[model samples]
Target: MSSRRLVVMRHAKAEQDGPTDFERPLASRGRRDAEAAGAWLASQGVAPDHALVSAALRTQQTWESVASGAGWTLSPDFDRGLYAAGPESALDIVRLVPDSASVLVVIGHNPTMAVLAQLLDDGSADAEVGASMAGDFPTSAVAVFSYDGAWADLGEGTARLEAFHVGRA
Candidate 1:
């Protein structure tokens, strides 16, 4: 069976002076970091067939930078629901993904992003990577998982945490 790849990433750093939290844009460092993240994913051979990104400005910008750095030409769906979605809600959105997409990427905000990575880990892979991820999920942190089942079948502890990376530029 051809396994599926799920790339879960937190939005890059953002300026704190936006008109509202949802409207905050990525800072200069965040853009560079996200681009670096994209390059890292590319190096790891992560070619996403689809991208689900939050409608928040920071996330959108992060997706753009990542795409540019990775040299990908795919467009992402801007989702307002993902903006404030917790890990469960985010997983719900992921479950709605089309099966044709063998590789999927989700860009969202914190707590949820970090927590979702932990929740999906099956603990059958690299323990050190899991430990590092458990410590902190800073800006541009990413967790890649390998799942043998369909997207609909994905759930807590169903996927193996393949890799963890933090992009810095």
Candidate 2:
């Protein structure tokens, strides 16, 4: 009953055929998707007390759209390590979140986000999330998990997947 919610969101759709993947900004569709996703989260009353975001342009742009649409005022922590981080790295970042925050959001890339969601999910709810882990996480996707303990105690099986949302149909 820690009341801590972890909202992990994959960055919005990014432009393709850029000079480099890291430099690619969010596409026009990405902005709309991000706005929709943020609005949806707001409707759920899932505003983040804190946010950790990747430093990539697409990720930053995605965060901007979501934060603006959600009316979020918390300053986000932009981390370079999150760009291509593995599941363990992502978990480490989550563990570092302050206990004072009732909710935290992480905006990052795929494969790692998908892996972290699968690893942390307890299967009590959202069976589809486990099955979907094998696939790639689309842009503006969110996986929400609730932990019974504090953020410092967050670990594998400590959380249960509360819900999952994807921007695309």
Candidate 3:
């Protein structure tokens, strides 16, 4: 049984000061929430073997804050594809992860993150969690799924939604 863990999250709230969307930074509340998200993951004893993050400023800042708060040493792979990518692109990215990584995290924009999480969730027995995740994904919200397949084989209906975490607002 080659079980794997996938964590998909939308970047925390970001500053509106940037001239362009890609240049926007995390807002004050975003920083705090990012740390809390890390703390919650740590409390659950969840540590990612690798992180695939978006290249945007806010996304990078979110991961940095989370790693610092969780006391985790994570080497992330930042790709532009995740910036405003759709669910299929997101799934393709997950499939590209090495098989050695048992746990992987992806931090990026919304809509896509939300769609990817919901697509993988399938009909997970936990109806409530599944419904909420598929409904809406807020800033700093994480959807954790367990997959019983290889990364290259990742796709819709192949994973179970184990839990969803939302940092303090």
- Candidates arranged by lDDT, highest first: 1, 3, 2
lDDT of 2 by residue, 1-169 (tens): 6468888889998888577888899999999899888887887789788899999889999889888777887889998889979999999988888888888999999888877887888778756765564466788988888878878788887787877877652
Alpha-carbon shift of residue 16 in model 1 (angstroms): 0.5
lDDT of each: 0.94, 0.84, 0.87
Model 1: per-residue lDDT, tens digit, 1-169? 6999999999999998799999999999999999999999999999999999999999999999999889888999999999999999999999999999999999999999998998899988787887888789999999999998889888999988889999999
Off by over 4 Å in 3: none
Clashing pairs in 3: none
The TM-score measured for candidate 2 stands at: 0.91
Evaluated at residue 129, the lDDT of candidate 1 is: 80
Give all TM-scores, in the order shown.
0.98, 0.91, 0.95
**Which candidate would rank higher by TM-score, 2 or 3?**
3
TM-score (C-alpha) between model 1 and the true structure: 0.98
**What tens digits encode model 3's per-residue C-alpha lDDT throughout 47-105?**
99999999999999999988977898988999899997899998898889988999898
Residue 130's lDDT in candidate 3: 74
Please give the lDDT score at residue 158 for candidate 3: 86
Q: Which portions of model 2 miss their true places by more than 4 Å?
A: 126-136
For residue 124, model 3's alpha carbon misses the true position, in angstroms, by: 1.8
> What value of lDDT does candidate 3 attain over all alpha carbons?
0.87
Highest lDDT against the true fold, candidate: 1
